[model samples]
Target: MAITKRGLVLGAAALTVSTAAIAGTGLHFFKGQALLQSDDSKQQVADADKDTSLQPMSMLSLQSFFNQSPKELVDEVWQIIDRTYVDGTFNQVDWKKVRNEYLKRPYKSNDEAYKAIREMVKKIGDPYTRFMDPQEFRNMKIDTSGELTGVGIQLAADEKTKKLTVIAPIEDSPAFTAGILSKDIILKIDGKSTEGMDVNKAVTLIRGPVGTPVKLTILRGTNQIDYAIKRARIEIHAVKSSEVQSPQGKIGYIRLVQFSANAPTDMQKAIKKLEDQQVAGYILDLRGNPGGLLYTSVDIARMWLSKGTIVSTKSRTGEQDREQANGRSLTNKPLVVLVDGGSASASEILSGALQDNRRAALIGTKTFGKGLVQSVRQVGKDSGLAVTIAKYYTPNERDINKNGITPDVEVKLTEAQGKALVANRDKVGTLEDPQFAKAVEVLGERIQAFRNQAPRAETKR
Candidate 1:
């Protein structure tokens, strides 16, 4: 997939400007500094073998560790592991027995120990932190986020049902070609039942090196269909937009696939074309868009928010930071936005900002409500940790974490309705799609009302 011009511009700008501003600065700097000077702390634990409830291991040992290591990067981690394992009732876990079982053969070095420890952590039944070896780090760096090699389809386990279901398939993907529609109940993969499988485990089974094939059995209605698909590297082009003329030949429709580096430029071009055609209004489709690139979202918001703060970010230091709108502003015309469950993260940011400012009317179900901001911290080569570093508050100071942004108009799409719309665009019914229908109605009203008003002097010129 080719990169959008907007994304390319944003990427270049980020590399030239933000890279210097972000690199070797902020929390990452402190974290890196701390990691370098904590050797004695490790040694103290290495030497201590007894599990005493109340034994002081010597502040001198700690100070000496600090002096010799000069960095506290891994110090806290070392201390936590030591303290937790020593007296924390580790649920009667026998470390010696585990070591004997896993490490029956002689191990080569500390790398083996790291792997063993990682496996032990997994045995505790937590999925959050998995140990990353050098090879994993390399693979992660080469692949972009969310673009895994597998049959192209989105999967999610229903929170209530806890059953694995097909979310959606990429356009022109192998899954799409195989007639795997959304919401199909996945019964098995490679003939292995999915009854007790978690989504991540299923993901692990489905994803592998490119060119490998996997078979899936899905339940559609009362019938079961099998699909054999070859895994291939999938490149997700996160943004797509065009200046499409409305059916009435009055307004222009700009359907944005996702927010990416190229979105702003693509939007600019689309708007320019619409302007040239003397379009009446705009319908911006943000449905099914999982967002990307925070700054790109900011840039798009600047086009609408003429002035004032767009969003505020509170960092770990209790300092509140705000991103102000640049001089760039839109044409001050009627705008309608569409959003739904798939619209999350940066998409929510833009939608919330526009609604807060009354710059646009939002129509759809509640957003995904991920108001937390995460920054990537490079732990090692090609391996980084993305931890929630801050929570963003909208212009109205609304927190959208668990509770997503509520659309001005609520709409739900039925499976039959969606299929009809996708199959024959002419058969699309908006009566059931209240949110989108409302947007169209609202835009029509705006067009009628704005058409009667005197054109702005800037617009007239």
Candidate 2:
């Protein structure tokens, strides 16, 4: 019998499979089995009637055996976690015991097996690590595609209040046109109470077929407002820019909502247009920006940084991977970054790189401090797993996980001031936004200092 390299690899992987070990690794068991080829030349490896006992069979027999039970599907999830979880020892939990406990319970259906799998993953105590069902996985795909059928608003839950709050509405979206402002508390969605509702669940409820309307009960400060927003196909523009005349001269203002697939390209065009207009300085606003793709963040960082480590990742075996800038500096203009509590993940990566390299001055409140990296892999044809594979650090080797990155100039926003800023965000040259106003002031001083320090040329005879 001729054994192929792929067959050998599959056989080795199957040999390592044990009932006691399984859970946090990124493994696609269904897909792996589908890749293996059956040897038609061989006869029946095992007869069901003759052997009723459990025994190791040929590669082809193993595939057939694995498909008969949903328990094997659960075991695949467990084994992946056992081998590839961020913590090698399952965070000191009795992983084998946990596995046995789940196995002991009879799973009558595939749903029960999925529930068991979720319960096993929750034991790891990492919120970022999660098992996504088919619907949840589909929603994730819709979010990343930059176009979705929904009201079109970014949302975040308050840590203290646990209330679902609107981060920002996409420009020209139904939510924005319906007057959904940042910091607005959503009491209910489509008459469904939002109390204690997970953000993802709420999103699922809010999104529906285009042309349908979703009713939202919003709490703005002490007053409550109701709006019926019709769902539409929203195309999110991750980057928005404009040139504003400031106290010094024309300053480039760019607001980065999220580091989506189109962020780098959109930002590149924004920067090029601003530079062409002869802007003296730039302010990159990341306030209320819930972060997105990691590679997009790194690509954006490379545009500003001439040379330095952008970000670093540390894995379970103390393996460290560093992403450094590619020595590409697009503009020498004085740069200032604006961040707040809403900024997270890839936002932190970009801010940390610029601040550590002394390329930009960070101004505003602290960041959201989500420093873990999640690798999403398909479990079966429908489901998937988003596992936290590593913890990331800034260029200065600072791990800002629970503790966020503090700004050089700390400016707190009062409740009333926050409401006013959201209302006037579209008004250009409006100094009512104190944080942005302060950024413009700081950049003005830096630009003036640069001009004064420049060596003047001598007048020719």
Candidate 3:
């Protein structure tokens, strides 16, 4: 069957590598106008004139003044928080007091109101629950659409060092082509130091119109290098696959970069191709994969698991929603999953599901623990909010939020080893990848055991 390659649209409530907008919230705004009689309209105009603030002014002044009262914006944000914030008690901080505190200040401009709202949201003590201004919201939408005009690198902030670090550069992207290596510390962007810089802010600085150049000062180990890379439109490919010859036989190797919209379909094709080759088993690589859509992860998990719960989500109200897999295993062959520190969110879900169900053995280091889920709510036409709505658990009911998942076969890749593997990912196989080599060895044993246990029939002469 021919599989159609679809665009990688990020679904809502995704455990994303970066703080990209994912999933949708069912919030809608309606604008209604009331018609007034001629006399009533005239009276309203006179009443407006009586109020000096509402009186006629220059077009520019009028535009600024009537851009919806900042108080109204503040109230809108406050209401959303009051109704939908995961913690109803605002984590023991009096939410009403927070609202009153922000409202007490005079906010004549939308920028001021946004600042106030951000401050109020910050009081909740959840970094993921953030306020996205119009521009940030627009950029998030662009990210969800699975296309970006940027240098094409994912970034993360170190919890201890607080340095902006390169997570991974998109394959064939401008950043990758410019030799931007993973784990490179971003010291400066366009001459501005990245010390204490937020990942989203760094993203904003790095992204721009196509063909624009971005200068980056990177610290790789003991050497510091400066790179000038031009931005380009990046179409992210979430799934890649290959076949590697191992001591046992041909091993099917598939790498899932993220659980983007196209992931499940692309992965299905990859598995089908490998099955056609009659590979003994499969190795699913998820190292350096920042997660994407939650549903995409569930879908991918279902491809391997024929039964049992895939994942479950718990909300503040103690409501639990569980997703179960249908009995439709794509291949009954033995499988091994590879993961590392960079694997997170949806990546965790998929690996955890496979591991929990005994469908596959997880290799590599522990994963990045991010079990919380964010729901994206549209605040305005050009603005939105990503609120933490729920926490997800693996099928085994483990919540690996701060504490990550421990791989069955622990394998740690040194910095130099990782750089070498990443530098030649497409060509390098078991020879360059210790994790891959180990997985191949493990799978080879499993295949040999299966053959040894199979019942043999006597052939009639």
In model 1, how large is the Cα lDDT of residue 348?
Answer: 79
Please name the candidate that would achieve the greatest TM-score relative to the true structure. 3
Estimate, for each residue in 362-421, the C-alpha lDDT of model 3 and write its tens digit. Answer: 988898777777655445333556666677889889998767799999988887786676
lDDT per residue for candidate 2 within 282-359, as digits (tens), equals: 999988665665666777898888789999877687744677888776887889999987777778989999999988
Give the TM-score (vs. native) of candidate 2: 0.77
lDDT of 1 by residue, 221-316 (tens): 788999898877655555444443343346766666545455677667777777787777777777755555565677778876787667776644
**Please, what is the whole-model Cα lDDT of each candidate in the order they appear?**
0.53, 0.67, 0.68
Q: Which ten residues in a row have the lowest lDDT in candidate 2?
A: 16-25
- The TM-score obtained by model 1 is 0.63
Q: Best candidate, lDDT-wise?
A: 3
Clashing pairs in 3: 11-23, 12-22, 12-23, 13-23
Clashing pairs in 2: 22-78, 22-79, 23-78, 23-81, 24-81, 25-80, 25-81
Model 2 RMSD, rounded to 1 decimal:
10.9
